[model samples]
Target: MKDLRLIFRYSKPYLRDLIIAVGLLIIECAFEMIIPVLMSTLIDEGVPAHDMPVILRQGGLMVVCAVLALVTGLLYARFAARYANGFAAELRLAEYAAVQKFDFANLDHFSTASLVTRMTTDATVLLNAVNTGLRPLVRSPVMLFMGLGMAFILSPRLTIIFLVATPILAAMLAWIVSKVAPLYGRQQSAVDHLNSRIQEGLTAIRVIKAFVRGDWENQQFDEVNTELSDASTETFRFAVLNMPSFQTVMYTCIVCIMWFGGNFILTGNMSVGQLTAFLSYVLQVLNSVMMFSGVFLQMTRSLASARRIREVLTEQPDLANADQPVTEIENGAIDFENVSFKYNAGAEKNALSDITLHIPAGATVGIIGGTGSAKTTLVQLIPRLYDATAGTVRVGGRDVRDYDLAALRDAVGIVLQKNLLFSGTIRDNLKWGSPDATDDQIWAACRAARADEFLDRMPDGLDTDLGQGGVNVSGGQKQRLCIARTLLKHPKVLIFDDSTSAVDTATESGIRHALAQLTDVTKLIIAQRISSVQSADLIVILDDGRLHAVGTHAELLAHDTIYQEIYQSQKKGGDPQ
Candidate 1:
């Protein structure tokens, strides 16, 4: 219950609607109880006494009550449904916003499937519970108590007989609730696992087919699906137990009422009308109890879902502001001052250890490293994607953390290793870098990245529709478009994270030529191609997350051992000549 406290907070805004719903529920319950009383009245008094006026008046009153109840119940259902849908929409939006606030490191902890389940399935479960469970939970208890009160007024001895069975039935229900709650929680967890497996299978369908592992994947999916099915069945078995057990108790109470009330009516201690009304009230109470059983089932599942939602809502974001946050960007040159970072704490070693470097404004620096050399991790620090474990990363001459995320990323345009072009017109994808760019500016940036040649050849040119991730385009074309998109932003610092690997040497040369023309922007080029680093203003060589060498091409040739080996290999291959 404590875990679900936040639900009330989100639901508070609909107080008026909730009040109207409950009010209508009360009226509906009153009408439902009256129908039984009216039936008993007609049977024992109006019909038996042969009074036409009394029967006609009671029948008319019954019709009016039934209509009023139907109308109010319909209005409540409509309002509750609409309000619940709206509430779910808002909750999903807020959950997505929270997910977006998380840094990449934090987001990586949860898979896409789990997040989707939290936002969609989990929220839906809770919303439905709120809507459907509200009416029964509010109305059933009142009806139960009201029916009991009316029965007691008519006859106390028979009311005592019905009351005797209540505590025993309640104890049975409490036991079932305790057993089923944990099962419901486990069921939802199994659902999340199943969703994750299905999502992975779909996203990697190409890989699965390439490996000819369709049967294997199908088996894996079945295993997860079976686990979910078992969990749900286990919970259902326990949930359904309450219904039959309660019904048995209800029948027992009904027998006791008929035996005692029949004797009293025959002995003239109670009138026939009173006995009939008392028996009707007993059935009404049993019906309300049954509705409550359904509510109980819904509440258990909703509680499980609410706990899952709270887990995400309560997660602390990886990056957040200081008590007094600074919001400014001062300079473009980045500095990694004794920065050490591990992807996670308690890991074996740092991804980048005690690294220190500086790049002045308007300088093109090339970083060369073997795989896992922390080249990407080092550059990632500049944008404050993940904070340094023990040191400071200064961007624009201030600690990168000082600037807000939007300002920091705006000042440094990064073309990631895996370039992606969304499904849209080419112009739309390019404009993502600079939404306000004129057509001329778009063309100019395209020319700078050496992508304009292909652009001109396309049938629709800038308006050409690209497939997902630009699959319709060649790999080199996608890379060029990504570079062109970044160029349009005109950031003070630009990073090409192996951004040119897909292009041929000739086109790569053209890109290098265009980059040299930048007059005022500082640049960081991470490349595996030796030719890409040869003409840089400075080249930093990294091995195993440590800086091994830093110098110009000639200087490294004269001094660095690894650079000599690389140079020899390229010279023999003549690939970079």
Candidate 2:
């Protein structure tokens, strides 16, 4: 219901169509009730008196009412479907936009598979509820109440027998519903879990085959599939029980009416016409209640889905943009003053700690460390990916928080360790770095990143399509293309987090030579290869989230023990020469 609240808030703007649809529903239900009464009158009054004119008049009126109801019902259903679907489309768009504002930290909270489920499966559930639930729960209830009242008016004494069965049936249905509600919630969660497993398997199929784990993967999938089946079966068992239970109770009530009302008519307590009309109204009420039973079952599942959606919509974003932030950079420099960061607050260890450094404008600095050195985390702060815990990160002489997120990131171009590519053309990917760039600007960027060579060899050149995650390109090609794309942006500061790692030594050297030619831009190169950082004006070494040393290549070899060991190891590995 909470998830439905958010959906309704979004759908509120389209209330006119909904109101009109409800108006039509009332008309349709009214005609439906009137036809039953017309049949009772034709049988007991017209047929008994042998009056052909009375039968014809009542029959003609019933036909006219049916036609009007059918036409209006069709129009109302058409409008309702269009409006509900349109509102769902709008809701999906809004959710997607909200997802875009989420930062890396927020993304980590929800798995990729679960997010897809929320956007597609959960949204569809809510949409169906809006389209169909309104008619059953809202209009059907009114019809039942009106029919019951009319039944009592026709014969209050006979209506008492029908009324006695209602509360017993209601209690039974409520109990079944209570038992099924938790199962539906668990069932939806099981489906999400199954979806995640299947999605992960498909995405990493190559890896699974490479490791010859196909049989194992199949077994794992079977386990999850079986779990989902069990959950669904549990929910369905309860749902299927409702119909038989409702039919038995309704039929019993009908038998009671026939036995008791037949006696009343024989004893001259009620007229034949009144007894017929009362039976007809009781049948109408029974059928309407039956319709609602099925609808209530579906609502149970929808309510579960709505709660799941609410969990996501109500989630407070931890990476919101700073309020009233300044417009642009005030200086072209970066400072990390005694910064320490732990991904999980109050954890025993930090991802980066006791990091103090200054990067003045127009300087080429390099960061080097072992696997857990926090080199990436150190640079991430400069772009405000994660805020520092015990210190401050200042960009342009002010706290990075003080500058607007767009402005701060605009000044920094980052080519991350994991090169990510979208499903688009090479040119489209590059244009993301600089949307307004001309062909000449793109070519110049490619040349500087040493990516133009292979890019030119492709038949379509920059227009060649890259598959999702750049699956169409090799690792080295992907890295160089990303570098070229970043270069096109021409940011004041560039952070290449081991961007050239996948390329050959010769190609890496060529890219480094090109990077050296971009003398105006500040460069922060983070790498494992000793040769990558050897040419930098300044080099900083980190170990176990702490600053190990900071100096030039020659100065580091002379003073820093950690840097000396790494340099010696690379030398023994022969520097890929």
Candidate 3:
């Protein structure tokens, strides 16, 4: 019921149309109900006495009732369609907006594939359910009681036949609902699993092909596909049982009605028209029950989807701006005072432990860390991607939490390890950080990042289409283009998380030299190669998520054993792998 209420809340704007649809549905059903009574009058008085005028009059009334039913049914369909589709569009938008608001911590509770399924397939199920279920939801009970009332009027004893039939069908449907409801949940899970595999395989298709793992990939896909198929088969099998059970009960009641009703007519207790009308009411009563069963099955599936959808809709982000946020960033100075962070609340240990560090405004700082040392995690804090589990991190001499999220993020630019470029022209990817940047400004950033070295050779230059994820460009080119995109933002603080690893040492040096000219910018570079950060004014070495050493390249090599070993390793291998 709570899930149902959530769906209705999203449907609030469309409620007027839904109410209008329900009203028209009731009127259409009322007109349908009157047709049978008109048929009874035509058969009883006109047919028995050969009264042409009575027959014509009753027949004409039946036609008018039929036309009225058709018109109202059409109007009901129009309003129902407007309500259902409008509700679905709004629900999907709300879900997308909710996902956009989720911070890294909140996002950890769900997966990319799981979120995709909830927003798409689950929302689709609800759309279809609402569209198909509206009529039955409104009409079934109305038709049932109205049919029953008219049945009792025609022959009360014969109406007793339905009581036995109704309960038998109801019990069977109740059992089916109980069995199928849980299976629908499992079925949706299977779909999520299948979609996860599909998304991963497609995204990493190049890696799979390079490794010649096509057979292995197929086997993985087959496992999830079969699981989905089996779940769908089992769920629908039980759900479809409703139709068979309804038919058996309905036919049994009809047989009893005919057998007992024929006796009533012969005994002069009922007329032909009355017996015929009673049979018509019996079909309506049982048909109404059938419609209810159909809706019951649909809602069973919809409720499962509703629960998943509501989970996203109701989620509270881990981060929000302070009530009175500091909207301006004064400078690029960053400080971490007694900071500790755990990705999960109940995690056995923190990813980064109690450590303090400070980088002055406009300082070029190099961070070298071993794997899992939380180098990337440290920079992510600047933009409040993930809040610290303990202590405070300050930027521009104020707590990062004090500033509005947009203001803080806009002041800090980060080029991630993975150089992801969307499918568009090279100019589109380059100007992503500053949508309104002039072509000359874009070219200047490109030269600074050494991206112009390749763009000069391409026939289309800036107009060149990069394809999906910049698949058209080489690894080094993609990295350079990504750097250019970030540089275009002209942020106060720039953090490069091993973003230049794809390029050679000389090219990387050129890029660093370009960065050196930005006197007002604070640069934090994380790299595996010692040469990449060897020229920084200050170097910070991290080992196992703790601050191991902070010194210039010469100062570190002279005293720090860890820095000395790293330098020797890179000297022997050209660059540390």
Candidate 4:
């Protein structure tokens, strides 16, 4: 119930439609309740008296009531649908927008598949609850009590039968709901697992085919599929138990009513018309009870989904701008003071340990490290992508945390280790670096990154489409495009985390020469090949999570054992000429 608060908040804007739908529902219920009285009147007086006028008049009124009821019911459905869909759209948008505001740290709690399910599948479930519940949730209690009132008027004795049955049915519904609530939670978990399996299999379909591991992927998929099927079956089986429970009590009540009402008619205590109308009202009352049970069951399932949605909306982003932040960077100089970081709060070991380093405003420095040395982690701190677990990261002599996130990121551009391009034309993807950049600037950036080599051969040039993740281009072309995009930002500080690994040594050297022309901007490069960073003003070698040595390329070759071995290994392997 606490988790359902957001649903009501999103529905605030559609209150008018909801109110109108409820008003129409009340009107329709009134018309339906009136018909049984008219049927009783015609049977008791008009039919027995053989008066055609009474019979015809009563029949005409019933038709009019039903027609009005039908019209109002249809109108109610329209408004309810509008209200539900409108709220659903807003809810999904809120979930998506909340994620956009989340810091990188917040993402550690949610998986890709889980996020997709919460936004799409869980949202749809709540939408269904609104659609199926809109009228029934209100109508059930309204009709039940109203029908009972009318039933007692016809024969109080028969009404007693209803009094005995209602509590038993209510208990049954409560028991069923209690049994199914946890199952619904399990059912949603199963859905998440199934989606995870499908997403993994689809995203890695090419790799699976190349490795001839289709059978293994299929087997993994089957496990999740069976888990989902079993969970859904168990949840729905209990959810649907209310119907049989309602029927069992309903028939017992009807049997008691007929036996007692027959004795009353024989003793001249009740008329045939009253007995017939009484039975009709009993049916209406029990049916409404059953309707309430169904709506209650449906809401239990929706509440499970609502809880999942709340997890996304209620998450507070750990990263935010300072109350009053420095807007402009002074220069490209960077400093890391006793910085240390661990990925999670309870992590046993730091990904990057206490380290202090500095680079001049316009120096080009190279960073080399073994696997799991936190090379990418160190660069991410500069852009404030992930805040350091401890210590101050200064950009342009100001604490990075003191700068506005937007301004800080604008001054620092990084080409991530894993380059990605959205599904769009090359020009559209490039514009992400600078939305308003001119074509000439774009071309210049492309030339600097050597992306022009391929663009010049393709007829589409910048207009060429780069399918999802730039799959239309080779890995080398994709890396170059990413670098070109980052160059368009004209950032004060540039950090490349092995961004040119796919390119050949010749092409990479050409890129480095182009970067050297930006004399005022600072550059930090992380690479596996010594040739890629050998010419830097300073080369920093990392061992584990600590900085092992910092020196010029020649100095490192002579003095640093780790740097010497890496260079020798690379020289043995030879550059990709």
Scored by lDDT, the top model is 3
Better of 1 and 2 by TM-score: 2
lDDT tens digits, residue span 421-526, model 1: 9999899999999999999999999999999989999999999999876878998999999999999999888999999999989889999899999968888999
In model 4, residue pairs whose N, Cα or C atoms come closer than 3 Å (at least 3 residues apart or on different chains), thus clashing, are none
Full candidate order by TM-score, most accurate first = 4, 3, 2, 1
Q: For residues 205-249, what per-residue lDDT tens digits would candidate 2 score against the true structure? A: 999999999999999999989999999998898888998998998
Q: Which lDDT tens digits does candidate 3 get at residues 319-406?
A: 9999999998999999999889989989998888887999999999999988999999888988899999898899999999999999
| CA lDDT scores, all candidates in order | 0.86, 0.84, 0.92, 0.91
380-441, model 4: which lDDT tens digit per residue?
A: 89989899999989999999999999999999989988889999899999999999989999
Q: Candidate 1: misplaced stretches above 4 Å?
A: 323-326, 467-471, 570-574
For model 3, the run of ten residues with the poorest summed lDDT = 568-577
Stretches of candidate 4 exceeding 4 Å from the true structure: none
lDDT of 3 at 529: 88
Better of 1 and 4 by lDDT: 4
TM-score of 2: 0.96
Residue 59, model 1: Cα distance from true site in angstroms: 1.0
10 residues in a row with least lDDT, candidate 4: 568-577
Candidate 4 RMSD to the real structure: 1.5
Name the lDDT of candidate 3.
0.92
My TM-score estimates for the predictions, one after another, are 0.94, 0.96, 0.97, 0.97
